[model samples]
Target: MSDVRVHNFSISLDGFATGAGQAPDAPFGHAGERLHEWMFATRFWHEMGGGRGGSGGTDNAFAAMHGPGVGAEIMGAGKFGPPGWQDDPAYKGAWGADPPFHTPVFVLTHRPRPSIEMEGGTTFHFLDASPAEALKRAREAAGGQDVRLGGGPSVIRDFLAEGLVDHMHVVQVPIVLGRGVRLWDGLESLEETYDIEAVSAPSGVTHLTFTAKSR
Candidate 1:
């Protein structure tokens, strides 16, 4: 089956999905950049946009999921940024001049915004589309390929509660957040079990594969 998945999402050992104090200026929150330090060290991120000479292994295994059957993506405003498409003179697409994902992206938001056409096939759809609406668009856009729940903790959690995702791969970081957003918050009843498909990665990033048990 086509998947609705969260792959390689990094979180601190302390259980915080993101750091505290988020806003238009600080999207990932104070020192939240630390949350994904492992990603930056990976060759996949480097090939995508991080330039060259980066470590591989963990990031590559995680990033290998990027192209394959993955066809579309859904992200919240916090992940896409600026919240509104009010035409900031300084507005830049989420990842500098261009983003890596060439597939259509549905960005979940409360306000209506215009679409952003980036260099690649990536056209950003500003969805006033609620979580359900966003998922619908992503599924359609996916063209039977898997749709990725590409992030901001609350957004992923919402899909989890709805039992939408078929699989997931999270790369647990060594540090801890102590407090902030959480991946499993209020999701204890989801009736899912992780088979622990793999544990060791060359980059010290643990790769965990999970599913809905019966699916």
Candidate 2:
């Protein structure tokens, strides 16, 4: 069976994955780009944007694992757009026309809409299903490859609670957001089931990997 994995998911020192007041302009909210500054400095990010010349260090090494062997992605509606995006019939997604996920992306939402096919082989499919049901659909869409769990924190938490994730890579940024959506709210003793490892990068962020022991 293909593994369900998460990569490059960022959180603050206080465990907040996203800040408050999420608008179209403020995607990450008050946290701004602090959580992803390390990623932006990576060579992988630069190359993804059709550019070059970025840090090719440990941070880059971790960021580079985001793609490859992932046939499909399952992201929460929050990751798709800001609040109230469902009311906008014209809203496509936060990513412009050409999204980075070059696979079938299933978005978890209560209001399902028609799938939107964009450039770079990225197609957005909205689903109103539980985490297990959504994963089933995503895995089938993934063909024989692994399924990437794209998240906005809450969705990741739900999947984690259900023991649906096989691999998870979390980046703990050095900042502290006192108020925001947290990742480790209800999850306790998560380290018991997964073999956890943490590596501190030169950019001051700690890369944490959680691989299921059964795997």
**Candidate No. with top TM-score:** 2
Question: How close is every model to the real structure, measured as TM-score?
Answer: 0.86, 0.99
Best by lDDT: 2
| Native-structure RMSD, model 1 | 2.6
- C-alpha lDDT of residue 121 in model 2: 96
The runs of at least 3 residues in candidate 1 whose Cα sits more than 4 Å from the true structure, single-residue gaps closed, are 23-25, 82-92, 191-198
Find the 10 residues in a row with the least total lDDT in model 2.
20-29
Every model: Cα RMSD to truth: 2.6, 0.6
Q: lDDT of each structure?
A: 0.74, 0.95
Candidate 1 per-residue C-alpha lDDT over 104-187 given as tens digits, one digit per residue, 9 for 90 to 100: 988777664677778777878878766777888888888999898898788888887777777877777787667778887887
Candidate 2 residue pairs that clash? none
List clash counts for every candidate, in order.
Answer: 2, 0
Residue-level lDDT tens digits of model 2 in 83-108: 99999998999998999999999999
